[model samples]
Each structure stands twice: as C-alpha cells, then as structure tokens.
Target chain A: MVVGFAIVAAWELVTAAGVIGFRRPIYNALALVGNMLGLAVLFLMLNAQFLFAAQVIVYAGAVMVLFVFIIALMNPESDVTLGPARGSEWMYGIVFGLIFAALLGVLLVNQGLTGRSGPFTPEVINAVGNVQSVGTALYTTFLFPVEVTSVLLLIAAVGAVYLAMRRIR
Target chain B: MPVPAYTFLLLSGALFTMGAIGFLVRRNPLVVFMCIELMLNAVNLAFAAISRYLNSLDGVVFAFLVITVAAAEVVVGIAIIVQVYRAGRQMDVDGLDLMKE
Candidate 1:
C-alpha cells in the first residue's frame, strides 16, 4: 500500500509539477505508465484479478502507446514546450484541487459513501475465481452496457479516422 | 491485516483532484489528455475499492468498461490534437482558439 501510494504521488508530481522538466512530456507519460502499473496491483489487492490484467494490458500498454506516439509526433525538440500556466490559472488549480481533496477527505472520514458490502467477498472470489465471477456478472446483468461499449469504440474509431484524414479535393 | 477500502478511496480522491488541477493548469493538449487519464484511473481505483467493499463483481466490470472507453477516447482525442497541431503549429490550449477573429 505504501509503495503504491508513493508511486501515485510521484506520478502526480511529475505530471502536475513537471518534476523532471516541463518540456519533457515523455517523462510524464512514463510516470503515467508507472501509476497504471501501481493501480493494477491495487486491483489485485481488491481481488479484481481480471481487471488487474486488463489494466496492465489496456491502460498501461495500449493507451500509453498512443500517448507516447502523439508526444513523439509533436516534434520532440521543436515543439516540446506546451506553454506554462499563468499565475492566476495556477492559483485556481491549486484552490480547486485542494478544496476537492478536503471535501472528499471529510466525506471518507464521515463514512458517507461506504455502501453495504455485497456477496462477492474474498472467500467467494477464491472459490469461483476472479475472472469467472467478473465474466459471469458482466455477461448476465450487464449485457446491454457491453454492447454499448462496442458501439462507442466503433464511433471513436470512425471519428478519429475522419479527423485525421485530409479533405479530398 | 488487509488494507481498508477507505484508504484506497482516499488515494483515489487525491489522484482525481490532482488530475483536475493538472487539467485546469496545464497548457499542453497532451498533458491535459494525460491528466484526464489520471482522473479516469482514479475512478477505476475507487470503483475497485467500492466493489470489493460491497462484495460484488460489478465494480470490476464497471472499471473494465471504463478502461475500454478510455482507450477509445485516447484514440480520437489524440487524432484531434494531431489535426490541431498540424494546422496551428502549437500545442498550447489557448492557442487553439481557431474561431478567434
């Protein structure tokens, strides 16, 4: 838990403060990759074995690849600078972020959002296996959402292609 | 002893807030995109924590869907960013005001 928290803290610092350097977004991407890997471990601790694998494969692997590719395409040396935030913007970001954190922290301390623990306890997960249990629930109760997810992916692909394509003369 | 779910939730909140701050403060489109992903990851962590605490598989399923959607979002968002960069030769979010007279 401590290690994971540290990794996440480092990720936020590098991404938000540009601890390595402001111009090097590659380092930020790497930090994100590390953060994702840490989250995967946290998922494992939660008995979300399937999600752990998926997070590693999808977020840490594929999504990060896209980010790195775009960052590289931006011309590493020439357009590295993405412009610094102005004084007021920094102040706003800090104020909003701190307020958000404080509010959520208070809520957690007050036990406001802790829902009743359900049926899939650690014992149940061990008995049925994490992957099988998640697959069962996903296909049975959540089938419609699965279909919507596929359609969303299709639309995103088409939109990306359309945006990237040059207009025909 | 196993860590409490609230601990994970708190970390998630921290991450989400940090991402929001980055989104508000960063001028680069790509960094902004990364910040958005960071927020999504925070949500995933929270989902997993709640799902575990609730003793249901639903949270994992939701997080799975979120990861998939985020992948799609990255594809399209980066495409748009690339297009904008091609046109303006700048990655600054303010400089993207193509509608300015």
Candidate 2:
C-alpha cells in the first residue's frame, strides 16, 4: 500500500516540477503511463478487479499510446516548454490548492470510512463474479447512461476525424 | 490490513493539487491535457477508495464511466490540438488565439 502511494507521490513530483518534461512532452506522457499502471494496481488493491483490468487495457494501453503517438507526431525534434507563470497567479493557485486539501482532510476525518454495505459484497461478487455484477448493474440500473456513453464515443470519433481532416475545396 | 480510506483520500487530494499546479504552470497544450488526466486519475482513486470503504459498487461504476468519458474527451481534444498545430505550426496555448483581432 505504501509502495503504491510512494509511486503516485514520486510520479506527481516529477510531472509537477517539470523535471523530465522541461523540453520533451513525451517524458511526461510516459510518466502518465506509469502512473496509470500504478493506479491499476491500486484498483486491484481496492478489490475492483474489473476496474483494474479496464484501467490497464483502456488507460495504460490505449490512452497513453494515443498520447505518445500525438506527441511524437506533432514535433519530435522540437523542444516543448511552457512559459513560466508570471506574478502572484501561482501563489493564488497554491493557496487555493492548500485550502481544498484542508477541506478534503476535514471531510475525511469526520467521515472516516463510513459506508453502507451494498449488493456487491465480497462473497456476492465471488458467487456471481465481478464482471457479471458490474455488467448487470450497468445494463439494468445504469442502462441509459451506458447507451449515452456509446453515443458519446461515436460522436468523439466522428468529431476527431472531421477536425483533423485537411480542408478541401 | 489494507490501507486506511483516509490515507487514500488524502493522497487523492494531494494528487489533485499537484495536477492543478501543473495545469497552471504549463504552457504547452499537450502537457495541460496530461495534467487534466492526472486530475481525473486522482478522482478515480478517491472513488475506488470510497467504494471499498462503503462496501458499495456505485463508486466503482461511476469511476468506470469517468474513464470512458475521459477517453472520449481526449480524442476530441487531441484532434483539436492537431488541427491547430497543422494550421499554425505552434503548440503554445497562448498562441492559439486565432479569433483575436
């Protein structure tokens, strides 16, 4: 568990500090892939086996590949760096982040893992299986949203093709 | 024993803050997108932690939806970026103001 947290912390540090990504966006993209893999392990630790597999297959495999491909295609030799943030804008951002963190800490301390048991207990999942339970719930209770997601994906594909296509008279 | 839920929550908060800082500091549009992904992953961690703590599957399901939506959003966003790059040969977010007179 601590190892997982350590991985996230180190990865966040590398990306946040722009250490590896000062000149190359590909490094940051790869770091994101590593972070995604770590999150998959965390999903497994949480007993979200199906989510773990999905995170690996979808996020680590597909999404990161897409990101790396884009970064490479955009400008392989060009150095990509952002201008340093000017003035007190960053100070404000830091203050806001600290306030948000404090709020989360307070909420977590007061709640402290209080949760009601649902249908997908460990034994229930063992009996009906994780994939089946998720699929059942997705198709039955969340059917509309599932269909909407499919539509969203289709629209995204069409929109991407249209946007990236060369203009033709 | 597994890690405490509060630990996961705190970690989520920290990751989200880091992502926010990255988003603020980065000028490269691609890096900004990556920061957004980091924020999304942080939220996913929180959802999984809550689901595990509550013995409920709802949080996991929502996280799954978040992942799916993120995939779609990335497709559209990167396409727009590619289009802008092809048009201007510039990747800086500040230079993307095509409509400014």
Candidate 3:
C-alpha cells in the first residue's frame, strides 16, 4: 500500500509541479515504466505472483522498451502536426466530470466498489483462482476467447511488421 | 496509517485519466503513446488487486502477458513513428492524413 501510494504520489507530484515537463515524451515514457514496476509490486501484494512476473518481464521490460524505441524513432521534431486539443475540450470535460462524479456517488452510496474483501488466505493457490484453475477455466469455458487472443496478436504482429517494413523503391 | 487497495485503485484511476486526457489533448505522438501506456498500467493495477483478493496467481500472469504485448506495441509504434517522421517532418497525428485527401 505504501509502495502504491508512494509511486502514485511521486508521479502526481512530479508531473503536477512540472518538475519534468509533461510535454517531454521521454520523461513521460520513463515515468510510465517506473509506474509499471510499482504496479508490479502492488501485484505481489495481491498475491498474484505470476502476474507480478509478467508485469515485470512484459510490461516494465518489453513494452516499455518498445515505447522508448518508438519515441526515439518518431523524431518529435517533425513539422508541427496535431493541434493541441486543450482549448476545445473544456465543454466535453464538464460532461465527463459530471459522469465521473455520478458514478463515484453511486458507488459510494452502494458501497459495492469499496466494500469487497476477498477471503484471500495466503495459500490461495491451492484454494482457488490460481494459474492452473484459470487455465482449466479458460480451456473449458473460455476456450474460444483464448484461441482468439492468439489470432488477434498474430494479426497485430503481422500488421506491425508490414507497416514497419521499408517501402520498395 | 497504511494505505489500502482502494487507494491504489483510485490513484491508478487518476493516472489513467491523466493519460487519457493527455492522449486527447497532447498533439505529439510520443505523448499519445505514453498515455496509452498509462492506461495499460492502470489495468495492471486493477488486475493485481483483484488477483490478490481472489488469492489467485493467474491475474498476475495475465498482467505479464499484457506487459509482453506492451513491448510489442513499443517496437511497432516506434518503427511507425520513425517512418512517419522520416517521410514527413513532424509527429503530430494530423500530419499523417495524406491518405485521406
């Protein structure tokens, strides 16, 4: 819990204070990677060891590397491109704010969002909701989706390679 | 007093919102990419918390898979960003609309 708060607070403070310019994509990306590691620790607290490993290996490690790579490659100095949406979004933001407030109000009144406590014994792996159980459930009940995940990933991979491929001059 | 899972979730929620707003409001491709990463990390926080509550390991594993996917996203996104910048001179989303007209 402390770790979670520390990470979030650090980021919120840093960004809010403009200690590092928010427009600096590198800092934002770096902060994002740090945030992912902090969340991985949070996962450990949740007793999701496998998830923690995945988070560290995949998100903090791999995905972030890719994000950095993209940042380096994108060349932020290209001709001025997308317009800042800042001025125009205020009206829509009010609607979003109201919706967020309404949702939080409902959640607070019902207590469903904050009130859940799991009967999470330390040895929950044997009790239930472990990797094996999830695998069994996925293969049995959610087999189609499991297979589809691969298909979608493959499609994405192919598309990426194709898109990134050099054009034949 | 020690913080709680709800606090993490709330913080995660706030970070995610920032990312979303940045993605929408920031004109730079890099910022948009960073925003997307922020949202993904928010989901990771939720998964971790729920996994802990459920006393299950699968959620973390799933989160790992998500991380892997994120890595892949970086490779491709960077490649495209490079290509786009090479062809043009900027990283704004609007600059790539040569296909539309």
Candidate 4:
C-alpha cells in the first residue's frame, strides 16, 4: 500500500512539474502506460482481481499500445507543445482550479457527515475479489448490468468500424 | 499488528488524488488518459474492499464492467488521436485547432 501511494505521488509530481511536456509525445505516452500499470497493480492489491486483470489486459495492454501507435503515426515534423499563457490569464486559470478543488473538497467532507460515506482505500481492496466470484455475482444478482455492458461494447465496436471505414475512404 | 481497512482506504484515496492532480495539470493527452485510469483503479480498490467484507462478489463484478468500459473508451480515444495526428501534423491538444489554429 505504501509503495502504491508513493508511485501515485511520483506520478503527480512528474506531471505537475512539467517533467512531461507535450513536446515528446512518445515519451509522454510511455509514461502514461507505466502509470496505468502501477494503478492496475494497486487495484490488484485492493482485492479487485478481475478488475486488475481487465485493467492490465484492456487498458495497459490494448489501449496504451494503441495510444503509442498513434504517437508513431503522427508526422514527426509537427510540434505539439502549447505555448505558456501570458500575464494574469495563467494566474486566473490556476485560481479557478484551486477554487473548484476547494469546493469539491467541502462537498465531500459535508457528504461524509450524512452517513453515506464509504471506504475508498487500498487496504479495503484485495485479491479475494477475483474473476470466479465476480462472475458468479454477475450471473446471479447483477445480470442486468452485464447485459447493458454487452450492448455498450457492441456499440463501441460498430463505432470503431465505421470510423475506420471513413478513414479508408 | 493487524491490517486495518482504513489503511487501504487512505492509500487508495491518496493515489486517486495524485492521479486527479496529474490528469489536470499535465497538458499531455496521454498523461491525462493515464490519470483517468489511475482514478478508475482507485474505484476498483473500493469495490474490492466491499466485496471482501460482504463475501459477495457484486462489487468485483461492477469493477470488471468498469474495466471493460474503460477498454472501449481507450479504443475510441486512440482512433481519434490517430486521425488527429494524421491530419493536424501535431499531437499537442493546444495546437491541433481542427478548422484553423
């Protein structure tokens, strides 16, 4: 758990300090991949076995690899970095973000007082939540969601095909 | 001596927060996507804990569904990014002003 938290902290630090500028798309993509892997490992530690695998197979394996491919596809001559904002505009944006963060924090803390608060921690998560148990639950109680997800995946597949076709044309 | 549930909760919470911060602060689209994944993983941890406590796998099922959705989301996002890169000659979110920038 401590290690997981440390990784998360490092990710936060790396990106926030401008260590991951958009100038290097491929490197940024790779870093993102590492971050996703770390997250999935942390998920497994939390006992969400099925989710962790899906996170690895679907996200880290499939999605991230595709993202890297996109980076490869980009024309090398193109520059991706956005120029720094001038004057008060930068300050204004940061101020608003801070305000929003503060508001969200207040709302969450208040909600905790209502007794509807639940755990969102790592220790609470673990490997007991594996594929076998998840499937049993899905087939039994949450069959409705499973069906809905199938429909969603179908739509996404069709959409991808359509988009790819347009590109080919 | 014994592991407390709060330890997990706090760990996941801190990680999720870091992810959120990374996603927002970074201009890189890839980093942003990774941060979103981090946040999703955090939720998975929450599901896991509840499942363990109840000895019911409902939470795990939900987490799996979320992961599948995330998979679909990534596919679509990458396809879009590919197209964007091909046309704009730039992957920077700021510079790729579709019509003109």
Candidate 5:
C-alpha cells in the first residue's frame, strides 16, 4: 500500500505541475485529465468507490472533454511572453505559495485528525455496499442540499444556453 | 499498516498550493479556470481521506456534490469564455479589464 501510494502521489504531483506549467492550453487540459485520473485512483484507494466513479466520469470524462473541445475551438495562443508589466507577478505567486504551504504544514503537524468517528466502518460499509450507504445518506441526511444543487445545475444549464444563443442572434 | 490520513492531507495541501500559484501566475483565463479545478480536486481528496479515516460517508457525499457543482461551473464558464473569444477579446486574464472602467 505504501509503495502504491507513493507511485500515485508522484504521478499526481507531476501531472499537476504539467497542468500549470504547460504553455499551450491544450497541453494544460491534457495534463489536467491525467491529474484527475490520478485523483480517481486515490479516491478508490480511500475506499470511496462511488467518488472514484464520479470523479472519473464527471471530471476526467465530461469536464476534460469540454476543456479540450473549447481549446480546439478557440485555438488559444500559448502564453509565450510575460508582458512588460506582469513579469514579476510569478515571483509574488511563488512567495504566496510558499507561505500558504508552510501554514498548511504547521496546521497538519500541530492538529491532526480530531473528528469523531462515525458508524460506517469498513466492515459495515462492505456489508451494506459503499454506493448504497452513500446514496442513502445523500437522500436522507443531505436531501435538501441535493435538491438545491439540482436547481443550481438547471440554472447553469439555462444560463449557458442563453449565453450561447446571444452570440448566434 | 494502511497509509496515514495526514499523508493524504499533505498531498492535497501541496496540490492546492500549486493550483493557487498557477491561478495567480498564469496569464491565460482558461489556465486560470483549470487551476481552479485543480484546487477543487485537492479539496475533494481531503474530503475523501477524512471520510475514510472517520468512518463516515458524509465526506464522500460532499465530494460528490462538489463534483456536480464544478461541472455546472465549468459549463457556464466555458460558454462565457467562448463568447468572449468570439467577441475578439484578448484571452489573457490581465488584459480583460473592461469592467474596471
């Protein structure tokens, strides 16, 4: 398990860096696809079978396809130049990243996982099935949020159509 | 023994930091959006890890919801980006400052 985790972790980091470091938008999109796939594998390792599926289908499959399609359609130019005024922006970005990482490290080291354990242990989940338990919880405990999310999705769909239609008209 | 939860959290934090840096440093708006997705994925990783460690399904469900929201956001955002591109606007986030005036 340790070796597997290490391999996946390395893959995740490399692909993530690719997503950010690639000059071309298409390459960035492709790198994100790889990163999402690595994340899906991690979800599986964490015993989140449903999340693994969702991450694969939704993120790697649907979302990345959209990104690649848009990149193809727009054919955006690679960011070759830093521009005259914005050249130093990356230095600030690096500094901010260092500080943010340091804070997270301190928090993780100081205060570890302190949350109360719940009822769904691995044995229980295995008996009930991972997807079944998650679905029941979603409908029972999280029904309201699920309904709201559906409404939000509907609104987003309508908004997207409206935005696209305006250009046609 | 199984992998520790803190390791997962650490990886998530690193990925989030990278995404934040990319969001700030990248000039292209599309890349910025990609960085946002990276950050969201990192959060999802933490959620799943914590959920497993805590023996709860809440984090998994929450991660699922986040995936849904991200999909919706991407659809709308990409549509807007396409519109902007069609309008002949520059693709750089720094250059698109029409609202400032």
Candidate 6:
C-alpha cells in the first residue's frame, strides 16, 4: 500500500506540474486529464469507489473532452504572446504558495481530524456496497442539495446554449 | 500498513498550492481555467481523505456535488470563453480588462 501510494502520488504531482508548466493549452488539458486519472486512483485507494468512477468518467472522460475540444476550436496561441509585463509575477506566486503551504501544514499538524466517527467504516461500506450507501445518502440525507445541484446543472446548460446561440446570430 | 490520512491531505495541499501559483503566473485564460480545475480536484482529494478517515460518507457526497458544480462551471465558462474568442477579444486574462473602465 505504501509503495502504491508513493507511485500514485508521484504521478499526481508530475501530471499536476505538467498541467501548469506546459506552454500549450492543449498540453495543459492533456496533463489535467492525467492528473484527474491519478486522483481517481487515489479515490479508489481511499475506498471511494463511486467517487473513483465519477472522477474517471465525469472528470477525465467528459470534462476533459470539453476542454480539449475548446482548445482545438479556439487554437489559441502558445505562451509566446505574454510579454514580460509581469516579470515578478512568478516570484510573488512562489512566495504566496509557500505561505499557503505553511498554513496547510500548521492546520493539519495542529487540529487534525477531530470529527466524530460515523457508522460507515470500510468493512461496513464493503458489505453494503460503496455505491449503494453513497446513493442512499444522496437520495436521503442529501436529497435537497442534490435537487439544487440538478437545477444548477439545468441552468448552466441553458446558459451555455444561450451563449452559443448568441454567437451564432 | 495503510497509508496515513495526513499524507493525502498534504498532497492535496501541495496540489492546491501549485494550482494557485499556476493561476497567478499563467497568462492564457484556458490555462487559468485548467488551474482552477486542479484546485477543485485537490479539494476533492482532501474531502475524500477526510471522509474515509472519519468513516463517513458526507465527504464523498460533497466531493460528488463539487464534481457536478465544476462540470457546470466549465460548461458556462468555456461557452463564455468561446464567445470572447469569437468576438476577437484578447485571449490573455491580463489583457481582457474591459470592465475596469
């Protein structure tokens, strides 16, 4: 388990760097695809089987396809157009990044996970099936949020269509 | 032995920081969008890890909701981006300051 986690973690970091460091938008999209896949593997490792599937199918499969399609359609130029207007931008980024990392480390080390444990342990989830339990929670305890999310999705779809149609006309 | 949960949280933090840096340093709007996705993914990872460690399904469900919201956001955002591109606006985020005036 340790070795597997290490390998996946390395893959995740490398691909994440690729997503940010790559000059071309297409390459960045592709790198994000890889990072999402690695995250799916981590979800599986955490026993979130449903999340694994959703991450793989929705994130890696559908969303990334949209990103890649947009990149292809727009075919935006590479990072060459970015003149040295903000030369010190990266230095600020690094400093802010270090501060954020330090804050996260302190939070994790200090507070840790203090929440009361719930009923669904790994063995229980395995017995009841990961997807079934998650679905039950979704339809029961989380029903309101789920409904709201569905409505949000509908609104987003309509908005996107409207935007596209406006461009057409 | 199983991996410690803190490790996952740490990785998520690192990824989030990288995404923030990318968002700040990258010039292209598409790359900025990708960096946003990276940050969301990192948050999802932290959620899953915390959910597992706490023996609860809430984190997983939240993560799922996040995924849904992210998809919707991407759809709308990409549509707007495409519209902007079609309008012959500057593709760089730094250059697209039409609202500032």
List chain A TM-scores, every candidate, in order: 0.80, 0.80, 0.69, 0.68, 0.94, 0.93
Q: What is the docking quality class of candidate 6?
A: medium
How far residue B27's Cα lies from its native spot in candidate 1, in Å, is 0.4
Error (Å) of candidate 2 at residue A89 is 5.0
Candidate 1 lDDT by residue in tens digits, A39-78? 8877877778899999999998999988888777785332
By summed lDDT, the worst window of 10 consecutive residues in model 4 chain A runs over A112-121
Off by over 4 Å in 4: A1-23, A75-80, A86-129, A167-169, B53-56, B95-101
Best candidate, lDDT: 6
The CAPRI classification for model 3 reads as acceptable
Q: Clashing residue pairs in candidate 6, if any?
A: none
Query: What is the number of backbone collisions in each predicted candidate, taken in the order shown?
Result: 2, 0, 17, 11, 0, 0
Model 2 residue A4 lDDT score: 70
Cα lDDT tens digits, model 2, B1-101, are 45677877777777788788767656678888988988998899899888877777788889999999999999999888887777755577666777674
In model 2, residue pairs whose N, Cα or C atoms come closer than 3 Å (at least 3 residues apart or on different chains), thus clashing, are: none
Rank by lDDT, highest first: 6, 5, 1, 2, 3, 4
Q: TM-scores for chain B, in order?
A: 0.93, 0.94, 0.88, 0.85, 0.96, 0.96
Query: Candidate 4 chain B, which ten residues in sequence have the lowest lDDT sum?
Result: B1-10
Which tens-of-lDDT digit does each residue in A1-169 have in candidate 3?
5766676567653552231235566676777777667666666666666666777877777777766776675546422234544465545545554565565455445532443455445565656545565566457756675676677678778877887677521
TM-score of each: 0.88, 0.88, 0.74, 0.69, 0.96, 0.96
Q: Which regions of candidate 1 are displaced past 4 Å?
A: A1-22, A76-85, A112-114, A167-169, B99-101
Model 5 spans with C-alpha error above 4 angstroms: A81-85
Instruction: Write the residue-wise lDDT of candidate 2 on A1-169 in tens digits.
Output: 7777667656655644552245578877877787788778778878889899999998989998999999888763333343444556467667877888788878676856656667666777768888888888789888999899999999999998988776522
